[model samples]
Target: MRVLIVGAGSAGLTCAWRLAREPSTEVVLIDAGVDPGPDVPSFLLRDMVLPPPFYWDYAEFDRGYFLPRGKLFGGTSAVNATAAVRGHPWCYDAWGSPSWRWERCLPSFRAIEADMQFGAEPYHGHAGPVPITRCELGGFDHALGDAYVRRGLARIADHNAPGHLGFGPFPTNRIGDDRASTLRTLLPELRGRPNVTLRPQTEAVRVVMAHGEARGVLVRTAQGDEQLLEADRVVLSGGTFGSPEMLFASGIGPADGLRTAGLPVHVDAPEVGANLVDHPYVQMGIEVSDPAKPAAPPGKGALLTFELDGPGHLQAHAFAYRTRAVDPSADPCSAAVTCALLTPESRGRLELGTGRARVRLNHLSSDVDARRMAEIVARVADVVADLASEGALRLPADPWWHADDLPAACRREVVTYHHPVGTCRMGSDTASVVDEALRVRGVERLMVADASVMPSLPRGQTNLGAMMIGHRAAEFLLEAPPP
Candidate 1:
């Protein structure tokens, strides 16, 4: 089997690692961004979110804000904070597909994680490509966590533990100080594989289809020459934004939108770019009570998760970190408590743009989401206030929470956690873009195995969930008798 995988991100790389192991299969992984070799910079390799890269042009529904999606070899995983959370079991059960339920998907989650701390546990895998370990927090982090405990947020034994909630360390994919990105882990294993080819700086423009099947992909090669790579199967692992954009460009999206965009419609799949969702983020700035105590670090020290509406309905992820708006040098004492709306009712959409997917993350569009986000922000502020009373922390004078109109403040400041999903929503129905097996509707020998195929957004960071999807896709392909 000759398989062509688009976008060498988390999912695509995982698929490559899985499929290339079979001698009968030949896999080609392509990415538009330049692939820095095994040894890349710490900022690109570790959890350091670099001063927004220029290649990240995907913006929010509000034109002013830019949504960052890493355009490099490892995609956002190469640039994101190394948070390796799979979220609660209910998050997966909410997908409404038995194949994707927590019970069925748990093995994939376990198969992909080589947890350093919880190796003996059945929920965690000890020998896998991607390394998972606990986040090592500092003194200020412990103080804030202690304050949260005092404020009634129970300290759980493990954050990744199923059904467990409250404040605990974020299980990150790291080895000592360095990161364990696919480039450093998964790719290295497939590097010398004779059947696998990793093509960096190669852009897949569109999937070439004929007779209701994907025949191959048209690409702009590294040297800027258009090339056609024929394949028996094509996997659209280009991620949420890139996958739908490619689909729309290839005339597989909503018919009216395709007509408006001057593209011929091949498949009138209305949901191709619809049902967009992401975890809307809210941040609260914090100051150290004593000037002597140093501020929190870049990555989250400890994380707290709780309910908004009810358990497994609307949840929020809270953590301590440094915000971009705060000057680290001038206000060395200032840090932030960031929270993201995990279960939002609001929906967003993606439209084809001149060169990319026009992402309309109508974040906080739902009044419920807007109000609930405000409530979470206010609740987090109240916890911080308790910390202040205990002489552990202080609040910024006239903080955004103190605004007379809290909802308006939420509308203004609600942002994305960079975890976008459901662009190519998966389900067991005809309306869904992909089936439970991730095969694109009305299309044969073509599949999507990235964050784009998620029926709904996961409750926590999506990096781990995305990799699990890729792992599951490879398993699906492997189990099925080859066509």
Candidate 2:
């Protein structure tokens, strides 16, 4: 069977790698980004730098904030900070699907990572393609950890450890100085595999549908020509934005919106681009005492995950890192701590604007979210104050977190953790865009295997979870009877 997969990101690449191994199955992987092959560019390899050519410029359209997503072969994983955090066990169990329960998802998670620090543990895998290592805490990180300990928080080294919390080193998908993106890990192995076709620089315009089945994809070639690539199955791995956009462009979203946009409606799935959830964060800049002091390694930082009293016992995490200066005149030595609300109650939506997808991440729109975000900021501020008292750094004259109207301050300072999910949410219910198996509802021969299909935001970085979805998608397809 020939399968055409769109978006060669974390999920797409993983699914392709797994499906290509089956000698009888043919996999065609396409992406709008350049195919760097094994020799990825230095900019893409470097952590904390989101190069323009490799990314889809959301253009500060999401409430005046930039939402960066990779447009390259490896997708966001190739350009992200190489964080490899897994979600809390309850995050999966809350999906309300037996196939996605924590117990069922653990094996796929283990099968994707070779944790250098905890490979021997029953919960981790030592033989996976991606290499996972915990970052070493620097002096500042140690100070931050000390503050958390003083606040009665325990130190948990492994954030990926089931339901573990508190201050610790963040797990990263870094192999030495380079990032272990699928472009480096899975792509290299899939190279020259006869059954796989890697077609980069190809933009998927829409899925070509007929009689409620996805016959193929209509892609715009790199040469500015349109082409139709047919397949028995088509999987949309274009991430939260890209996947939903693909569905909208294919005339398979809310009927009213599709009709207003002058597109034919194939399926009136209202949730196609709804249920957008992301970790809302606010960054507090810290001016160091010594500007000449060298910074810690990129992708290396300490994380403090804690719980807040909410209806769902909401979670949050704060991490410190040296901020990268995009402007030439800005101080490159400045560090920043980001306090993010992991389990936010706010919901956003993705709509079609002209020919592209328009995103509105109604972050902190919920009263619960604003209140808890303020609480998180207040807690993080205490830690920052401790650092300032020790003369390690200087704080802003009027720190936003220190404002009397903290919830309003949080609203003003809120930004994305750069982790967006649930655009094409999956569930057992009819309103969901896809089923528990990741298959797009009402559409045969089509599946969504990426962050887009997540029913809700998990309590950690989504890079690793996205890879697990891809692995599980391949298994689901493989186990099912062929059409």
**TM of each candidate vs. truth:** 0.95, 0.97
In the predicted model 1, the residue pairs found to clash are none
TM-score of predicted structure 2: 0.97
Q: List the residue pairs that clash in candidate 2.
A: none
Candidate 1: segments with Cα more than 4 A from true spot: 47-54, 290-295, 298-300, 309-312, 324-330
Q: Model 1: per-residue lDDT, tens digit, 1-483?
A: 888999888999998898988998899999998787866766666445456541467776455576777788888787777777788888899899888989888888887778898878877788888888876676567776777777778887577888777887878887776767776788878888999988888899888999999999999987889999999889998899989988887889899989989998999999998899988887787777665655445443678888876655678888886543234355766777887888988999888777667789888999888888888988888877777888888777788877787878998888888889999999999999999999999888889999999988888889989999998988888787347
Top candidate when judged by TM-score against the true structure: 2
Which residue ranges in model 2 land beyond 4 Å of their true spot?
60-62, 290-298, 325-329
